[model samples]
Target: GDPRLQHISQSIRVVPHFPKNGIMFQDITTLLLDHKAFKDTVDIFVDRYRDMHISVVAGIEARGFVFGSSVALGIGAKFVPLRKPRKLPGEVIYEKYSLEYGTDCLEMHVGAVQTGERAIVIDDLVATGGTLSAGIRLLERAGAEVVECACVIGVPEVKGRCKLLGKPLYVLVEPRQVDQCF
Candidate 1:
Protein backbone atom coordinates (compact mmCIF):
# COMPACT_ATOMS: atom_id res chain seq x y z
CA GLY A 1 0.00 0.00 0.00
CA ASP A 2 1.16 3.53 -0.63
CA PRO A 3 2.53 5.17 2.51
CA ARG A 4 0.52 8.35 1.84
CA LEU A 5 -2.56 6.14 1.84
CA GLN A 6 -1.90 5.39 5.50
CA HIS A 7 -2.25 9.07 6.29
CA ILE A 8 -5.39 9.16 4.20
CA SER A 9 -6.85 6.19 6.05
CA GLN A 10 -6.07 7.63 9.46
CA SER A 11 -8.07 10.74 8.69
CA ILE A 12 -11.34 8.93 7.93
CA ARG A 13 -14.03 8.76 10.62
CA VAL A 14 -15.86 5.48 10.96
CA VAL A 15 -19.42 5.82 12.18
CA PRO A 16 -21.21 2.70 13.29
CA HIS A 17 -24.80 2.23 12.10
CA PHE A 18 -24.96 5.22 9.86
CA PRO A 19 -28.39 5.59 8.16
CA LYS A 20 -29.14 2.14 9.59
CA ASN A 21 -28.01 -0.51 12.04
CA GLY A 22 -25.01 -2.86 11.94
CA ILE A 23 -23.18 -0.83 9.35
CA MET A 24 -19.75 0.67 9.74
CA PHE A 25 -19.80 3.66 7.45
CA GLN A 26 -16.36 5.00 6.48
CA ASP A 27 -17.12 8.66 6.64
CA ILE A 28 -14.77 10.90 4.58
CA THR A 29 -16.04 14.24 5.87
CA THR A 30 -13.24 14.18 8.40
CA LEU A 31 -10.70 13.64 5.62
CA LEU A 32 -12.10 16.69 3.89
CA LEU A 33 -11.43 18.81 6.97
CA ASP A 34 -7.68 18.17 6.97
CA HIS A 35 -6.06 20.36 4.32
CA LYS A 36 -2.96 18.21 3.79
CA ALA A 37 -4.89 14.94 3.76
CA PHE A 38 -7.46 16.28 1.37
CA LYS A 39 -4.83 17.62 -1.00
CA ASP A 40 -2.79 14.45 -0.72
CA THR A 41 -5.82 12.33 -1.48
CA VAL A 42 -6.45 14.23 -4.69
CA ASP A 43 -2.77 14.54 -5.52
CA ILE A 44 -2.26 10.81 -5.35
CA PHE A 45 -5.02 10.27 -7.87
CA VAL A 46 -3.91 13.10 -10.10
CA ASP A 47 -0.36 11.79 -10.14
CA ARG A 48 -1.40 8.28 -11.12
CA TYR A 49 -3.68 9.50 -13.92
CA ARG A 50 -1.76 12.50 -15.19
CA ASP A 51 0.25 10.44 -17.63
CA MET A 52 -2.45 8.03 -18.68
CA HIS A 53 -3.73 10.10 -21.62
CA ILE A 54 -7.29 9.81 -20.35
CA SER A 55 -10.01 11.63 -22.26
CA VAL A 56 -12.77 11.82 -19.68
CA VAL A 57 -13.28 11.49 -15.94
CA ALA A 58 -16.78 10.26 -15.05
CA GLY A 59 -17.69 10.78 -11.45
CA ILE A 60 -20.48 8.97 -9.59
CA GLU A 61 -22.91 11.48 -8.26
CA ALA A 62 -22.26 13.46 -5.02
CA ARG A 63 -18.99 12.29 -3.47
CA GLY A 64 -17.35 11.36 -6.73
CA PHE A 65 -17.74 14.95 -7.81
CA VAL A 66 -15.44 16.04 -5.00
CA PHE A 67 -12.43 14.13 -6.39
CA GLY A 68 -13.32 13.53 -10.03
CA SER A 69 -13.69 17.16 -10.94
CA SER A 70 -10.34 18.07 -9.50
CA VAL A 71 -8.75 15.09 -11.15
CA ALA A 72 -10.20 16.04 -14.50
CA LEU A 73 -8.88 19.54 -14.14
CA GLY A 74 -5.48 18.20 -13.24
CA ILE A 75 -5.31 15.89 -16.24
CA GLY A 76 -6.92 18.29 -18.70
CA ALA A 77 -9.85 16.03 -19.36
CA LYS A 78 -13.56 16.74 -19.50
CA PHE A 79 -15.52 16.04 -16.33
CA VAL A 80 -18.67 13.96 -16.67
CA PRO A 81 -21.10 13.49 -13.83
CA LEU A 82 -22.96 10.22 -13.49
CA ARG A 83 -25.87 11.40 -11.38
CA LYS A 84 -28.94 10.07 -9.63
CA PRO A 85 -32.18 9.89 -11.56
CA ARG A 86 -33.64 13.25 -12.71
CA LYS A 87 -30.66 15.25 -11.47
CA LEU A 88 -29.24 15.88 -14.91
CA PRO A 89 -31.11 18.54 -16.90
CA GLY A 90 -30.54 17.28 -20.38
CA GLU A 91 -31.24 14.43 -22.75
CA VAL A 92 -29.84 11.76 -20.48
CA ILE A 93 -29.25 8.02 -20.45
CA TYR A 94 -29.61 5.89 -17.34
CA GLU A 95 -28.65 2.54 -15.87
CA LYS A 96 -30.55 0.82 -13.04
CA TYR A 97 -28.71 -1.43 -10.60
CA SER A 98 -29.40 -3.52 -7.50
CA LEU A 99 -28.43 -2.37 -4.05
CA GLU A 100 -28.00 -4.43 -0.91
CA TYR A 101 -31.59 -3.67 0.10
CA GLY A 102 -33.33 -2.30 -3.01
CA THR A 103 -32.56 -0.78 -6.42
CA ASP A 104 -30.91 2.46 -7.43
CA CYS A 105 -30.17 4.15 -10.75
CA LEU A 106 -27.46 6.36 -12.28
CA GLU A 107 -27.89 8.82 -15.14
CA MET A 108 -25.56 10.44 -17.61
CA HIS A 109 -26.31 13.14 -20.12
CA VAL A 110 -26.27 12.19 -23.77
CA GLY A 111 -23.05 13.17 -25.59
CA ALA A 112 -21.23 13.56 -22.31
CA VAL A 113 -18.79 10.87 -23.38
CA GLN A 114 -17.93 10.38 -26.98
CA THR A 115 -17.70 6.90 -28.37
CA GLY A 116 -14.29 5.22 -27.89
CA GLU A 117 -13.15 7.85 -25.45
CA ARG A 118 -10.88 6.66 -22.66
CA ALA A 119 -12.66 7.22 -19.36
CA ILE A 120 -12.29 6.51 -15.66
CA VAL A 121 -14.97 6.32 -12.98
CA ILE A 122 -14.48 7.94 -9.60
CA ASP A 123 -16.28 7.53 -6.31
CA ASP A 124 -15.46 8.20 -2.66
CA LEU A 125 -16.02 4.67 -1.41
CA VAL A 126 -16.88 1.19 -2.65
CA ALA A 127 -19.06 -0.92 -0.32
CA THR A 128 -21.11 -3.31 -2.46
CA GLY A 129 -19.56 -2.18 -5.79
CA GLY A 130 -23.03 -2.01 -7.36
CA THR A 131 -22.76 1.75 -7.84
CA LEU A 132 -19.40 1.53 -9.64
CA SER A 133 -20.71 -1.33 -11.77
CA ALA A 134 -23.58 0.84 -12.89
CA GLY A 135 -21.25 3.67 -13.70
CA ILE A 136 -19.11 1.33 -15.82
CA ARG A 137 -22.14 0.03 -17.70
CA LEU A 138 -23.37 3.52 -18.38
CA LEU A 139 -20.00 4.51 -19.80
CA GLU A 140 -19.77 1.36 -21.87
CA ARG A 141 -23.25 1.96 -23.23
CA ALA A 142 -22.09 5.43 -24.21
CA GLY A 143 -19.26 3.66 -26.09
CA ALA A 144 -16.51 4.75 -23.77
CA GLU A 145 -13.64 2.49 -22.79
CA VAL A 146 -13.53 2.62 -18.99
CA VAL A 147 -9.86 2.53 -18.11
CA GLU A 148 -10.53 1.93 -14.42
CA CYS A 149 -12.51 2.77 -11.30
CA ALA A 150 -10.99 4.68 -8.40
CA CYS A 151 -12.19 5.27 -4.87
CA VAL A 152 -10.77 6.70 -1.69
CA ILE A 153 -11.69 3.78 0.55
CA GLY A 154 -12.77 0.16 0.17
CA VAL A 155 -14.55 -2.27 2.51
CA PRO A 156 -12.58 -5.46 2.09
CA GLU A 157 -14.88 -7.74 4.09
CA VAL A 158 -17.78 -7.12 1.74
CA LYS A 159 -15.56 -7.79 -1.29
CA GLY A 160 -17.05 -4.92 -3.24
CA ARG A 161 -14.40 -5.31 -5.94
CA CYS A 162 -15.95 -8.63 -6.94
CA LYS A 163 -18.99 -6.85 -8.33
CA LEU A 164 -16.99 -4.67 -10.73
CA LEU A 165 -17.07 -7.18 -13.61
CA GLY A 166 -13.25 -7.28 -13.77
CA LYS A 167 -12.63 -3.60 -14.18
CA PRO A 168 -9.49 -2.65 -12.28
CA LEU A 169 -10.16 -0.83 -8.99
CA TYR A 170 -7.82 1.51 -7.12
CA VAL A 171 -8.43 2.32 -3.49
CA LEU A 172 -6.29 4.49 -1.30
CA VAL A 173 -7.18 2.73 1.93
CA GLU A 174 -8.97 -0.16 3.56
CA PRO A 175 -9.93 1.17 6.94
CA ARG A 176 -10.11 -1.15 9.93
CA GLN A 177 -12.99 -0.77 12.36
CA VAL A 178 -12.01 1.13 15.47
CA ASP A 179 -13.98 0.85 18.68
CA GLN A 180 -16.50 3.64 19.01
CA CYS A 181 -15.86 5.79 22.05
CA PHE A 182 -18.97 7.91 21.90
Candidate 2:
Protein backbone atom coordinates (compact mmCIF):
# COMPACT_ATOMS: atom_id res chain seq x y z
CA GLY A 1 0.00 0.00 0.00
CA ASP A 2 1.14 3.54 -0.69
CA PRO A 3 1.66 5.09 2.71
CA ARG A 4 0.90 8.56 1.46
CA LEU A 5 -2.56 7.73 0.17
CA GLN A 6 -3.46 4.52 1.96
CA HIS A 7 -4.97 6.07 5.04
CA ILE A 8 -6.51 9.04 3.31
CA SER A 9 -8.08 6.99 0.54
CA GLN A 10 -9.37 4.40 2.95
CA SER A 11 -10.94 7.09 5.05
CA ILE A 12 -12.95 8.40 2.13
CA ARG A 13 -16.19 6.49 1.74
CA VAL A 14 -17.17 5.83 -1.85
CA VAL A 15 -20.94 5.75 -1.81
CA PRO A 16 -22.61 4.65 -5.01
CA HIS A 17 -25.72 6.39 -6.26
CA PHE A 18 -25.60 9.19 -3.75
CA PRO A 19 -27.89 12.23 -4.20
CA LYS A 20 -28.98 10.59 -7.49
CA ASN A 21 -28.62 7.52 -9.62
CA GLY A 22 -25.22 6.34 -10.92
CA ILE A 23 -23.27 8.69 -8.67
CA MET A 24 -20.21 7.68 -6.72
CA PHE A 25 -19.79 10.19 -3.96
CA GLN A 26 -16.36 10.59 -2.44
CA ASP A 27 -17.51 11.21 1.07
CA ILE A 28 -14.98 12.89 3.34
CA THR A 29 -17.05 12.64 6.48
CA THR A 30 -15.34 9.37 7.18
CA LEU A 31 -12.01 11.04 6.62
CA LEU A 32 -13.00 13.77 9.06
CA LEU A 33 -13.69 11.13 11.62
CA ASP A 34 -10.13 9.88 11.38
CA HIS A 35 -8.19 12.58 13.21
CA LYS A 36 -4.84 11.50 11.84
CA ALA A 37 -6.12 11.32 8.29
CA PHE A 38 -7.78 14.69 8.55
CA LYS A 39 -4.71 16.31 10.05
CA ASP A 40 -2.49 14.70 7.47
CA THR A 41 -4.70 16.03 4.72
CA VAL A 42 -4.48 19.57 6.04
CA ASP A 43 -0.80 19.16 6.77
CA ILE A 44 -0.21 18.38 3.12
CA PHE A 45 -1.73 21.75 2.24
CA VAL A 46 -0.16 23.66 5.13
CA ASP A 47 3.34 22.50 4.33
CA ARG A 48 2.87 23.58 0.73
CA TYR A 49 1.55 27.12 1.42
CA ARG A 50 3.17 27.95 4.76
CA ASP A 51 5.82 30.05 3.10
CA MET A 52 3.99 31.12 -0.05
CA HIS A 53 2.82 34.40 1.59
CA ILE A 54 -0.80 33.80 0.69
CA SER A 55 -2.74 36.78 2.07
CA VAL A 56 -6.18 35.23 1.97
CA VAL A 57 -7.58 31.71 2.00
CA ALA A 58 -10.86 31.73 0.11
CA GLY A 59 -12.90 28.62 0.81
CA ILE A 60 -16.03 27.54 -1.00
CA GLU A 61 -19.16 27.05 1.06
CA ALA A 62 -19.74 24.06 3.36
CA ARG A 63 -16.95 21.47 2.97
CA GLY A 64 -14.33 23.98 1.90
CA PHE A 65 -14.70 25.63 5.28
CA VAL A 66 -13.22 22.58 6.99
CA PHE A 67 -9.88 22.51 5.19
CA GLY A 68 -9.75 26.16 4.20
CA SER A 69 -10.08 27.49 7.74
CA SER A 70 -7.48 25.07 8.99
CA VAL A 71 -5.08 26.04 6.25
CA ALA A 72 -5.72 29.73 6.94
CA LEU A 73 -4.93 29.30 10.62
CA GLY A 74 -1.80 27.36 9.80
CA ILE A 75 -0.56 29.90 7.27
CA GLY A 76 -1.51 32.97 9.29
CA ALA A 77 -3.94 34.21 6.67
CA LYS A 78 -7.54 35.39 6.94
CA PHE A 79 -10.26 32.91 6.02
CA VAL A 80 -12.78 34.22 3.50
CA PRO A 81 -15.85 32.18 2.75
CA LEU A 82 -17.57 32.02 -0.63
CA ARG A 83 -21.09 31.18 0.33
CA LYS A 84 -24.51 30.66 -1.19
CA PRO A 85 -26.70 33.70 -1.84
CA ARG A 86 -27.88 35.66 1.22
CA LYS A 87 -25.74 33.64 3.60
CA LEU A 88 -23.46 36.56 4.32
CA PRO A 89 -24.68 39.40 6.54
CA GLY A 90 -23.03 42.50 5.07
CA GLU A 91 -22.97 43.67 1.48
CA VAL A 92 -21.60 40.92 -0.76
CA ILE A 93 -20.47 40.28 -4.28
CA TYR A 94 -21.71 37.21 -6.13
CA GLU A 95 -21.00 35.15 -9.22
CA LYS A 96 -23.37 32.91 -11.16
CA TYR A 97 -22.15 29.60 -12.49
CA SER A 98 -23.42 26.32 -13.96
CA LEU A 99 -23.33 23.09 -12.03
CA GLU A 100 -23.76 19.65 -13.57
CA TYR A 101 -27.40 19.73 -12.64
CA GLY A 102 -28.34 23.40 -12.72
CA THR A 103 -27.06 26.95 -12.31
CA ASP A 104 -26.20 28.39 -8.91
CA CYS A 105 -24.45 31.38 -7.40
CA LEU A 106 -21.74 32.09 -4.84
CA GLU A 107 -21.39 35.18 -2.70
CA MET A 108 -18.64 36.77 -0.72
CA HIS A 109 -18.56 39.81 1.52
CA VAL A 110 -17.77 43.07 -0.26
CA GLY A 111 -14.53 43.53 1.63
CA ALA A 112 -13.54 39.97 2.31
CA VAL A 113 -10.38 40.48 0.32
CA GLN A 114 -8.41 43.66 -0.16
CA THR A 115 -7.25 44.97 -3.49
CA GLY A 116 -4.23 43.09 -4.87
CA GLU A 117 -4.25 40.64 -1.99
CA ARG A 118 -3.02 37.16 -2.90
CA ALA A 119 -5.67 34.50 -2.45
CA ILE A 120 -6.00 30.72 -2.80
CA VAL A 121 -9.41 29.15 -3.41
CA ILE A 122 -10.14 25.92 -1.59
CA ASP A 123 -12.63 23.13 -2.13
CA ASP A 124 -12.77 19.44 -1.29
CA LEU A 125 -12.68 18.38 -4.91
CA VAL A 126 -12.76 19.73 -8.43
CA ALA A 127 -15.28 17.91 -10.59
CA THR A 128 -16.85 20.37 -13.02
CA GLY A 129 -14.78 23.33 -11.69
CA GLY A 130 -17.60 25.81 -12.31
CA THR A 131 -17.90 26.60 -8.61
CA LEU A 132 -14.19 27.20 -8.13
CA SER A 133 -14.06 29.23 -11.30
CA ALA A 134 -16.88 31.38 -10.00
CA GLY A 135 -15.07 31.92 -6.71
CA ILE A 136 -11.98 32.98 -8.59
CA ARG A 137 -14.01 35.37 -10.71
CA LEU A 138 -15.65 36.88 -7.66
CA LEU A 139 -12.28 37.36 -5.97
CA GLU A 140 -10.73 38.94 -9.05
CA ARG A 141 -13.70 41.31 -9.30
CA ALA A 142 -12.99 42.30 -5.71
CA GLY A 143 -9.43 43.07 -6.86
CA ALA A 144 -7.78 40.06 -5.30
CA GLU A 145 -5.04 38.24 -7.17
CA VAL A 146 -6.02 34.59 -7.03
CA VAL A 147 -2.76 32.73 -6.63
CA GLU A 148 -4.16 29.26 -7.18
CA CYS A 149 -6.81 26.69 -6.26
CA ALA A 150 -6.38 23.78 -3.83
CA CYS A 151 -8.35 20.61 -3.41
CA VAL A 152 -7.82 17.22 -1.82
CA ILE A 153 -9.17 15.29 -4.77
CA GLY A 154 -9.37 16.16 -8.46
CA VAL A 155 -11.71 14.76 -11.07
CA PRO A 156 -9.70 15.48 -14.16
CA GLU A 157 -11.87 13.77 -16.76
CA VAL A 158 -14.47 16.43 -16.11
CA LYS A 159 -11.87 18.92 -17.31
CA GLY A 160 -12.55 21.11 -14.33
CA ARG A 161 -9.02 22.44 -14.20
CA CYS A 162 -9.35 23.74 -17.71
CA LYS A 163 -12.17 25.99 -16.55
CA LEU A 164 -9.67 27.93 -14.42
CA LEU A 165 -8.25 29.37 -17.64
CA GLY A 166 -4.57 29.28 -16.55
CA LYS A 167 -4.53 29.30 -12.76
CA PRO A 168 -2.38 26.72 -11.01
CA LEU A 169 -4.09 23.78 -9.30
CA TYR A 170 -2.71 22.07 -6.20
CA VAL A 171 -4.08 18.73 -5.21
CA LEU A 172 -2.96 15.62 -3.28
CA VAL A 173 -4.99 12.73 -4.64
CA GLU A 174 -6.05 12.49 -8.27
CA PRO A 175 -8.24 9.50 -8.95
CA ARG A 176 -9.01 8.62 -12.52
CA GLN A 177 -11.88 10.82 -13.67
CA VAL A 178 -14.95 8.82 -14.63
CA ASP A 179 -16.73 10.92 -17.21
CA GLN A 180 -20.24 9.61 -16.66
CA CYS A 181 -20.07 8.89 -12.94
CA PHE A 182 -20.75 11.58 -10.44
Whole-model lDDT values for every prediction: 0.86, 0.84
Clashing residue pairs, candidate 1? none
Candidate 1 TM-score versus the reference: 0.92
RMSD in angstroms, candidate 1? 2.2
Across residues 31-84, which tens digit of lDDT does each residue of candidate 1 receive?
Answer: 888898899999998998989889999999899999899899988999999999
Q: What lDDT score is found at residue 48 in candidate 2?
A: 83
What is candidate 1's CA lDDT for residue 160? Answer: 31
Which residue segments of model 1 deviate by more than 4 Å? 157-163, 179-182
Best TM-score goes to which candidate?
1
Q: Given candidate 2, what's the lDDT at residue 181?
A: 23
